[model samples]
Target: MTSSDTSVGPSSDLSQNAENFNWLLSRFAGNTAGVRDAIAVSSDGLMIAQCIEGERADVDRLSAIVAGMTSLAGGVAGSYRLGTLNKVIVDMADGYLLISAIGCGSVMGVIASKQANLGQVAYEMTLFANRAGAALTPELIRELKNHIQV
Candidate 1:
């Protein structure tokens, strides 16, 4: 995916931590031109927040897909005696899909156009995912428990 020229401001949530998440998303989006959408979702495929353009994609479905892919990759790695899953990239005709593990059970996903640079996108995603893991882990666990209870 090519780099995007657009820039988005940070989200105005009362929590400073949330604002940090927004900043990460904004920075990631701004740096990638082919990045049509990006989102932070729990490992169980629940969306925490998203920055999207044009028609709204089904975030839940996307998250679930990424989570499954991540799990599958992990399983494959395990069979080979590999430790953990780092990232998975799905190349399509029109664009590329990237997913990286954030923490214990969370993943960050990005959808970018075919012209986007995979190497740069991967690097930025790794950085963003690391920060997001630190910022989102507690909230995500609480939210996940609530969903489970419900």
Candidate 2:
């Protein structure tokens, strides 16, 4: 695994959380070049916010896939004596999908282009996870769930 455990928790979503999420994600993308887009998902795999300008990605499908992958990665780590599941990076032919645990039950999923700086992207993702984790409380998750139809 090319990832390491990062100790950063979620942030507060009790306030104008959506905007905060967007800002944090935007700043994250800006700080790291080559980030095509990013999404904030609950630990259970529900999309809370997206920080892209163009047509949105299929949140439902991506959420499910990311959640499943994250769980699988955790299982693999546990079975292999891997310390902790910091993040999961899938290097595709054209791009990368980076998933990192935000807090207890949420994750931040990022999609970066092939030209993207993967190392920096991964580092920034951990940063996002740490900050976003605080915003993923049960109440906030429930709140985010209410906003989504599925």
Q: For model 2, how many clashes?
A: 7
Task: Give all TM-scores, in the order shown.
Answer: 0.76, 0.75
Q: Pick the candidate with the highest TM-score.
A: 1
| Clashes by residue pair, model 1 | 1-115, 1-116, 2-115, 2-116, 3-33, 4-32, 4-33
Off by over 4 Å in 1: 1-13, 54-57, 140-150
Provide the global lDDT of candidate 1 against the true structure: 0.69
Score candidate 2 by TM-score against the native.
Answer: 0.75
- Give the Cα lDDT of each candidate: 0.69, 0.69
Report the poorest 10 consecutive residues by lDDT, candidate 1.
1-10
Model 2 lDDT per residue over 12-114, tens place? 6334675566567667865678886677677666677655444334555666777788889878998999977788889999999998878756777788899
Q: Among all windows of ten consecutive residues in candidate 2, which has the lowest summed lDDT?
A: 1-10
